[model samples]
Target chain A: MKIKKVVELLNAKVVSGHDHLEAEVEFCFASDLMSDVLTVETENLLLLTGLANLQTIRTSEMSDISKIIFVRKKNATEEMIRLAAENEMILIECDYSMFKTSGILFSAGLKPVY
Target chain B: MMHFEFHVEGGNFLKAGAASSQLKKILKQLNVDPKTIKRVVVAMYEAEVNIVAHAYKGDIYIDIDTKKIEITLIDEGPGIPDIDLAMKQGFSTASSVVREMGFGAGMGLPNIKNNSDELTITSEVNKGTTVKFATYLNQ
Candidate 1:
């Protein structure tokens, strides 16, 4: 799915990487634990997490995940935004709960990174 | 062969993944396979975070050759009391602050082991800990 579609479906705000909305993400992994995120090995994955910290961005960068959707309306700090921008990672924010966000995306045919 | 070294300050969450990030970029420049790069980065990043969240200070040394990349992380900290116990998933000794950051789920070592081709860990209770792991470049 295109990141733009995710943003539209979840009513998410583009927190960073506005130019990369057309980027395609093949899978989604939702976790608040950074360690679990590290365990995922999917390519072109979209990370859905409530953990709004520098490590989130770092984890995404390390895992080659180009896009992140922050559920629960969590705000990304300036440092987080700066790092995502520097890494050319797309960041999205949504007011919906993690469950709702996942449901919406899954129903839209976004597969989970299992 | 290429060697890179970095220093890590414990509790410096902000700078935790610097070494791994740089290594990822270098691996990309070297045209390492995407799957290999992902494995290497995941394992190394976990090791790096272990230092930031647990140790007092640490150093990361990477030796990359045509076939593989080996990483050694040594840190001064209150080392693990039981390596076996620490290896179990969901077992963590991280401070509440560390846990609050969504880490310390006790999956760091396992994640490293899962991603790396080989992994070795040694620690002395009150002294320090050292983790050495490697990922194949041609895998």
Candidate 2:
């Protein structure tokens, strides 16, 4: 699924990396645990996380994850946004809980990493 | 061989993985295989976080060559008393503050072991700990 579609479906706001909305992501992984997020080894993966911090961006940097959805109305801090922009990461914010965001995206053809 | 050294300040969440990030870029610029680079980054990042979350201060030393990349992390902090216990999944000594940042879920070492081709750990209770790992580029 394209990140653009995800933004549309979840009513998410793009916090960074607006230039890459047309990029397609084939897999999705939802986790608040950075360690668990680091365990994933998939390409074109979209991370659905509620953890809004610089470490989240660092985790994405290490794991090669370029797109993220911050659920439950979690706001990315300025530092997080700056790092995301630097890494060319598309960070999205939504009011939906992690469960609802995952359900909607899963129903919309986003394959789970597991 | 290319050798790089980086310092890590313990308990500073903001600067935890800076070294790993830098190493990832270097690996990419050197034309290392993407898969190999990912493995190196994952393991290195986790180990780097371990130092930040537990140690007083740390140092990262990286050596890369045509065949493989070797990394060593040494830290001065409250070292692991039981290496066996520390390696267990889901067992962690991270403070509440660290947990809130979505880390300290006790998967760091296991993740490192999973991603690296070879791994070793040594520690002294009050002195510190050292982690060394390698990933083969040609594998």
Model number with the top lDDT:
2
- Alpha-carbon lDDT of model 2: 0.93
Instruction: Show pairs that collide, candidate 1.
Output: none
Cα RMSDs, all models: 1.1, 0.8
Clashing pairs in 2: none
- Candidate 1 local lDDT, A23-90, one digit each (tens): 88778899998888888766778889999999899988988888999999899999999999989988
Q: Chain A of candidate 1: what's the TM-score?
A: 0.97
lDDT of 2 by residue, B16-132 (tens): 889999999999899988888899999999999899899999999999888889999999999999999989999999999889988888999999999998999999999999999
lDDT, candidate 1, equals 0.90
Candidate 1, residues B1-139: lDDT per residue as tens digits?
8999999999998898999999989998999988888899989888998999999999999999988899999999999999999999999999988887878899999888899888999999889999999888675
Q: What TM-score applies to chain A of candidate 2?
A: 0.98
Model 2 agreement with the true structure over A12-80: per-residue lDDT tens digits: 899899999999999999999999999888898999998888999999999999999999999999998
Top candidate, metric TM-score: 2
> What TM-score does chain A reach in every model?
0.97, 0.98
TM-score, model 2, chain B versus true chain B:
0.98
